[model samples]
Target: MSLLFYSCNSQKKAQKKEAETHKVIQKKYADLLNVSTTEIKNVRLYAFIEEWTGTPYKYGGLSKSGIDCSGFCNVLYNQVYQKELPRTTKDIAKQLDKVKQSRLEEGDLVLFNIEGKKNAHVGVYLQNNMFVHASTSKGVIISSLENPYYKKAYNKGGKV
Candidate 1:
């Protein structure tokens, strides 16, 4: 009887620890994204972003040391949503259903036309017009779609 009681207590403690950890993660991302903790519905997604944040940008690199826009999006999608995406931004864009910027939702793909080339850049939309991407200059960072450069280069939103 004592052993059974101890086992139950241990299980309860484990669950409590897990819940606390989840709250911490949610609070961290809520602050980073400038949203309320309740607005962060996907803890796994935020955790993944936190893990890869600040990774260096590389043209075709795929590892932690360096990753490109498409590579980052692909890794994110595959891990978070269990969806496999094409390697190139153009190819990934081709597979998506076009969506207007105003209709974008969480997990949507944001394509950009840089330097007059269509679909030259890509990012994973998070929420509140914020998206995560591997920028050529800033590496992996979260950016707002309202930024002047992104606004001008915005091509279209893509939904899988």
Candidate 2:
């Protein structure tokens, strides 16, 4: 029984160590991405996508507890691409160069603004016209760009 108890303790320690290692790795990659090093280690942006999936949404928030639309984009870009972007959807809307939606890559950011309306929301692309966002009520979730709501409100997409 003592042996089993020791093993359990070891396992917990190993899990804790692994979690620490992940933070180190994430920080290292974020640093590289921030510098725009010619070679990016993780082209697997999807790997990063799944990290923040399903976080609850909140106004004036930029963390897992809750997050707004532009807050989602800001966090993704800063963490994945290591670029600090403007936090407000409106600021992000005008900062990036426009790209055709058909050509959007995984790291590209999407903006949704109804016709004749100012940009009010943002999200990160996943693929197949899918993006991830923290909605006002839906929280952090993957969304279909082709969804009727997003389709009608589509503004444009941009690469960081």
After TM-score superposition, what is the CA distance of residue 44 in candidate 1 from its true location, in Å?
0.7
Q: Where does candidate 2 have its weakest 10-residue lDDT segment? A: 32-41
Tens-digit lDDT string for candidate 2 (19-112): 6666565565445334332233354454565566778888898887887888888877877778999978888877888899999876788988
Instruction: List candidate 2 stretches off by more than 4 Å.
Output: 1-44, 114-116
Position 44, candidate 2: lDDT: 46
Model 1 Cα displacement at 118 (Å)?
1.0
lDDT on C-alpha atoms for all candidate structures: 0.93, 0.75
Off by over 4 Å in 1: 1-14
Cα RMSD (Å) per model?
A: 2.0, 8.7
TM match of model 2 to true structure: 0.69
